[model samples]
Target: MAITKEEVLHVARLARLELNDAEVERFQGQLSAILEAVGKVAELDLSDVPPTSHPLEVSNAWGEDVPHTSLTQDEAFANAPERDDDHFRVPPA
Candidate 1:
């Protein structure tokens, strides 16, 4: 989990970053600590835990689908600035 100075510089190069000596040293320690913290997960006993996409139980909150009365063609075209019979008219692409 100990990130090397060379690894830090390599990462900075990949990210198109120009890190000074101080920044490189700082990031090296920070990245090492982060990796050590993340490595703790491997030590956990997760055999009894089920694999899930989400940590919490979730369900779709959708309302019942029902048919309803719709506007007529005349009503739909009433506010149109330009119309072409049954469709709204638009400028040619």
Candidate 2:
């Protein structure tokens, strides 16, 4: 399918883009080529193909969940630039 200059202008206007005459002409050709390629893909016969979410078969690759000891309050706040009692202090937002 060919994309018209008017359609490109309309889309640019909807997107709040200010395209010059040259840009509009350039995008019209580029978009038309992209649409033509997509149309070619749509014309392919894929009746026997199954819809796949991924190109490769991927199973859960996560490691076993194991509980571990976390840093203590004092240890966690040791590198804080500013601290009050036991917590790190931050500048007012």
Candidate 3:
């Protein structure tokens, strides 16, 4: 569908934008052309085309997780900047 100047103005209003008469006319043409391009693309035969989010295969850099020995409480607390026996101490709230 062709986008009218009024439709452009309405969209501008919805977006809280201020457009002059010339700007509205320009946007009406630009947005209409975009719709026309999309419409043309929609007319293409693509029944065999598969839906894909990305053309390339994607994967996480980190590998599968495995159980491993973790640090003990003493080792974890050895490097604390501020600590109270078994817990971190912060400034008064």
Candidate 4:
């Protein structure tokens, strides 16, 4: 899992990044460490563990949907800067 300087340079080129020699060397070590850590994770024993979609239980907290009274058109449009017969108007973008 050791990342080489050439591989770092190639990755930077593919990503359209301009890195100096120091940055290339730095990223080489950092990327190599990340890959090594991931490799260690692959060595874990989880044969008996059941796969789960989520780590925690999930449920909706919303109340039941219900209809209610609403403001009239004039009341709703009272604060509008501009309006047509029954709708607000805005300039074209």
TM-score of each: 0.49, 0.49, 0.48, 0.47
lDDT of each: 0.92, 0.91, 0.87, 0.90
Over 1-93, each residue of candidate 4 has an lDDT whose tens digit, in order, gives 999999999999999999999999899999999999988966989788787767777766577789789999999899998989899887875
Residue-pair clashes per prediction, in order, are 0, 0, 0, 0
* Cα RMSD of predicted structure 1: 11.1
Per TM-score, what order, best first? 1, 2, 3, 4
Estimate candidate 1's alpha-carbon lDDT, on a 0 to 1 scale. Answer: 0.92
RMSD of each: 11.1, 8.5, 11.1, 9.5
* lDDT measured at residue 34 in model 1 versus the true structure, 0 to 100: 97
> Could you give me the TM-score of model 1 versus the true structure?
0.49
Candidate 1's residue-wise lDDT over 1-93, tens digit each? 899999999999999999999999999999999999989987999899776777667788677899789999999999998999999998996
Prediction 3 TM-score vs. true = 0.48
Q: In angstroms, give how far residue 52 of model 1 lies from its true place.
A: 7.2
On lDDT, the leading prediction is 1
Number of clashes found in candidate 2: 0
Most accurate candidate by TM-score? 1
Q: How far is candidate 3 from the true structure (C-alpha RMSD, Å)?
A: 11.1
- Residue-level lDDT of model 2, residues 1-93, one tens digit each, is 989999999999999999999999999999999999878966889898887778878878688789889999889888998989887899986
The CA lDDT at 24 in model 3 is 93
Model 2: C-alpha RMSD to truth? 8.5
What's the residue-level lDDT of 70 in candidate 2?
Answer: 95
